[model samples]
Target: MSHAPTGARRREIWLLVATFLVAVAGLIYELIAATLSSYLLGDSVRQFSLVIGVFLSAMGVGAYLSRFVGEALRGFIWAQILLGILGGFLAPVVFYAYAWTGAVELPLFGLLIAVGILSGMEIPLIARVLKEIGAPEFRFENVLSVDYVGALAASVAFPLLIVPQLGLMSASLVFGALNLAVAGLSLWLFRSDATRSQWGVWALALLLTGAGLVQSERLVTVAEAALYEDDIILSETTPYQQITVTRFRDRVRLFLDHSIQFDSFDEYRYHEMLVHPAMSHASRRADVLILGGGDGMAAREVLRWADVAQVTLVDLDPRVTGLFQSHDDLAALNDNALRDPRVRVLNQDAWQFVEHANTQFDVVIVDLPDPKNLALSKLYSRAFYSLLMERLSPRGVMVTQAGSPFYARQAFWSVVQTVAAARNPVQVGAGPWTLPYHTYVPSFGDWGFVMAAPFAPKTGDLAVPPGLQYLTPAIWQQSHVFGADTGPIEADVNRLQSHALVGYYLDGWAKWFE
Candidate 1:
């Protein structure tokens, strides 16, 4: 017959399990806090660095303070209960504070310190408990080894499974439950060792964690409500980015990963300039390709020409394309361009789409976001432009949204230089004529665009369509001129390996913050 394990063996098993559980739970909380901070504030590097620094310092403080506690087992149990309660509710509280008071740093850092201190004490107490119970193999080294393994698992699970499946708000509560589970199991196993106060704290922690689990979804909605200015119509977290649509009166806005993509009120100025400049100069507008214009605003501008036979739009996010396709207000804003018979939407990465494209386009509009990160920097690289050049018709035109020349002059010039470096197609030997232009949009001031064509383009050749709300022939030509402040500066070509453009973009925009 199988017999119950001896107390020593049981203690060894529970302590090891506790070490692993606490390690995973602790790192998950740290990641969630850092991610939320990055989303709310700009610059991922800065936010993550600060969160990790504060967490590790607090952990050191906790470890040092653990020497004062008399009972190791009691200390471990209380630490687990406190960690579970505070860490589980952290995300929701941070969000609520931001929404109600526009204060996030204090509450965020306060919770991180609390969770870190409690987590730091967990492994030390577990090691002490096992040694006291006469476990021969219970050493600090063994405890630390198991803790590191748990950390590796948590790092993998965070982005791949936790954030995508459970989201930041709910994931915290789930991990918090794991923390409480460790404490509850320890309480059951060591019932003879527990004091009255430890039992009461454990009960209260269970009640609080259970409530968080049940109300997780509602709590997430309430927290997210504060992040947007208008009423959120829909929000989805995809592997690539966070997609949010908000509506205020007749105006609608789309935000990708918490950065504003567009606001309906003044988007026409941006879209009109992006499209008409290239469309008007191109020899034929019949076949058009649009990369990264998921909202369909650019397509709407291209579709104005009755002669344009087909418009193929490639955007990375299906969530973005699907939202515009289904929403009545969003559809109407784009003149139902996504649903147009002549327009075909492909939900795929723009880089992959361009590299393998079998068809040639008379006009290609590159309306991608600014090169703020590595993934986006590749799109602005010379390699991407070279591949794009091969797909253009003999006399075709291409235009890219180069960002605010006034704010990011070096980045804007880098794009202009990259397009020119792509060189003119052999079929049309006259030039790889590059035209840099900027227009004032109230939402985004002094935005820039670079238009490149196989043959030299003339302002006189532009056949601008009638009824455009923003773009006039006079203003179209005038956009080529720039004020002294927004003028071009020399910049290195953005190669995939170097990724120098992201640095330039960051440096250029950093001044605004200062």
Candidate 2:
């Protein structure tokens, strides 16, 4: 039989609840700091690693400092109030710092340490509070076990619920409010032990966090204005990525995860360079397949060909495909290519689509972003190339947008080498199995492309489609001749297991930024 609840037992239960809520709040702050840093700066691996390292070390500092507190209950309550204020305002402060000043790493690591130290104080103080209320019934082990469970729960909810629903700024404020509530509950439970000073701090924390929750959207807008040069017309955070479109007069720019996808002014040159070479080289223009041109610019170029019958475009993000399909301003840029009856859009991962596609295509265009991270690096691997080669018809030709050869020479060469290695055998009327070509775009300088076919066409065999803004027949032939700085040299093939392109890409680009 269960006994009726006593005041002591109920106070202990409330203490345990406070422990869980504090743990969740602490972890959410850490994640928000790490994610925001990664978004603003490239190289997610470096940002997360450094942020976690600084955070954990500062936590150790907080733990050591906790030994000095004489009044355990008062110390714990005050720590909660301080942590609530710090973690609540962290995202907005960091974003404002980034916008006004170029120094992000300094403030980013500083806040990580501050929050980590305060959060570190929390678990130890809560453990002490539990002991003060009830001696042997609530052991140190029980408090620690509850703390760990809360952390695990927070980690799961961060990506699945918190980030998807509240986003980075608002999520921080909500969790901050929760932290302040824990402090309030602790003061109420231990009213006999609390002083007026502690109550005052809790009230101040409550007011600040309330203001943060209300002003989060305004803060996001101001930060965005500083980050982007053009006026931002549309911005949305999808489950997959951050999609932002900015407009500067007549020119429109699309940014995905803060990386530039295309600028409308010069996109014709990039798209024409991507689509025309393969379409002209292919024996048949019918049944064309595009791997990652979700923007519909590549499809727009492909449709210009008179002989083309059906165009299948596969892209991972439905948000991107849907926007390009519907939005009038964006649709006008792609010439309403996605809505065209001849084109079929499949919102799926390119890697999975290639693996599952049984049909063959006469022309294939790969217009994916640069492989700066692991997820994108996989798209450039030899395994992906092998899968892509499987879908090419006997007389088919393929083209892929290799990044700037001048800036990322080794990475550019790696793409060219990987495509050739994937198609190593089966020589069919060859002058060269793979041809590397590049054209200058005003937006992105010295961009490269690799045109591969089962049978190599002659030097002047490829023809540019009519009604093109860039790439005439003569200009197409001239694009193959790259200057000394931009021309390729020897590089290792990018394999799935090794992921050589990611390293090469980082090494090549990091120097430019420095």
Candidate 3:
């Protein structure tokens, strides 16, 4: 039979628990900083790398500074309190900095480094305190093991529970509260070690973070409102992305991860141009597949053809498709296309869907976003297009929305080159003729598209249906013409192995935006 632990052993156990909690909180702050930066700044790879580098280096700095500490208990408690306040408020501060100033590098990285330093000092101070308290079996390895376990828990929970449930802003505050609670636990465990002033500071920090937690929704709204020009009517933090809808006067706009998807006023121009080109060129519009366009705008145009028998739209995000399908206002924008009897919506990744699809499509329309990251870059790759070629019928045609020809010249041409490079799996040595075109849309300037087929698509006799706001026969012919400056440049074919399109896209846009 085992007896209860002695008071001395109990104190050591509690201190080790405190070390574990500190590790959890510290890593939570690091992930929050990295995710928040990625959402605001774009280029997730660069943002995460930079944040991790700075945070780990700052941790080293904090460890080096721990050697000069006089009172281990007081120093540990102070670090917890300070870390709680800073890490808890990190998201809101960074959000506001980006929203108001149109810049975020300084405050985001500054807070990241500060939080890292405090987190770094935690384990060393805990070990020192255990030694001071005369822990019977105060092995440094035990404390380090607990700390590592805590870090693992935090890493797993952050993406699965914290981010999906609490979101970045609320997660920050919730973790901040947890840190203060840990500090309070330490004070209670050793009442004589902490002064009245330390307790007072901890109480104040708790109050601030608690209030922030309660009002985190309002805080997010206010911060997000400052980022856009119009009043936001709907906002949702989906597990996949931040979905926001804003309205000004009669114009409604959609934004995914702070990037404008479409402005209702001129969306017809984009949607019409995106959908009608391939639809008009295809010999049989009986079966169609749309890779993106979760808003159902592309489906709206496809339904214009009475010859279209079935339309299958595969999008990655259900929130986007569901909103466009159910929301009264958003549904009307798509003319209830997603709800039409002939349309089938499958919320699945386009790449995976194409690879496994057994049925062939008469017209394949790729209305996906630009190749901003590696995930998106694959959709524009030669391998992806090759897979798509297998899904295209013998006389079928496919069209993809390339990025802006004026701004991202190489990225635009890369799509064309990639599509042209795709070999038809069904017909060996068959020509996958490609046509590159561009048209002006007010919302997205100089937008481009590339259409490919096993045979040379007859553009001269396009059976363009009536009622199009843009893309008339004359306009369609004009879109094929590019100015000397906007003309295609030599570009590497985008492949899954290299993901060259993402680099070209990021580099091209950065020059204009930065």
Give the number of the best model, judged by lDDT: 3
Please give, for residues 277-373, the per-residue lDDT of candidate 3 as tens digits: 8988888999999999999999999999999999999999898999999999899999999999999999999998999999999999998877888
Clash count (model 3, backbone only): 0
| Residue lDDT tens for model 1, 229-292 | 7988887777667788888998888888777888898999999999998988887889999999
Tens-digit lDDT track of model 2 for 1-514: 7797777777788888888888888888888888887787766776788788888899999998888888778888888888788888888788788888867787778778888988888778878877776745667888888888999999999988988788787888898889889889888978988889889988988988898788888878888899899999988776667888999999899998778899998999999989988888888989999988889999999999989999999998898999999998899999999999999999898999998998989898999988887778888887887677778887788889999898899999999999887843345333227899998998888889998877766555657767888888777878889888877788999987888888889888887964
Error of model 3, residue 45, in angstroms: 2.0
> Which candidate's TM-score is highest?
3
Off by over 4 Å in 1: 3-11, 45-70, 97-114, 135-149, 209-225, 356-359, 423-431, 458-461, 490-492, 507-510
- Which consecutive 10 residues in model 2 have the weakest lDDT in total? 423-432
Stronger candidate by lDDT (1 vs 2): 1
TM-score of each: 0.85, 0.92, 0.95
Model 1 lDDT, residue 191, Cα: 89
Point out the higher-scoring one by TM-score: 1 or 2: 2
Q: Write down the lDDT that model 1 would get.
A: 0.86
lDDT at 241, model 2: 72
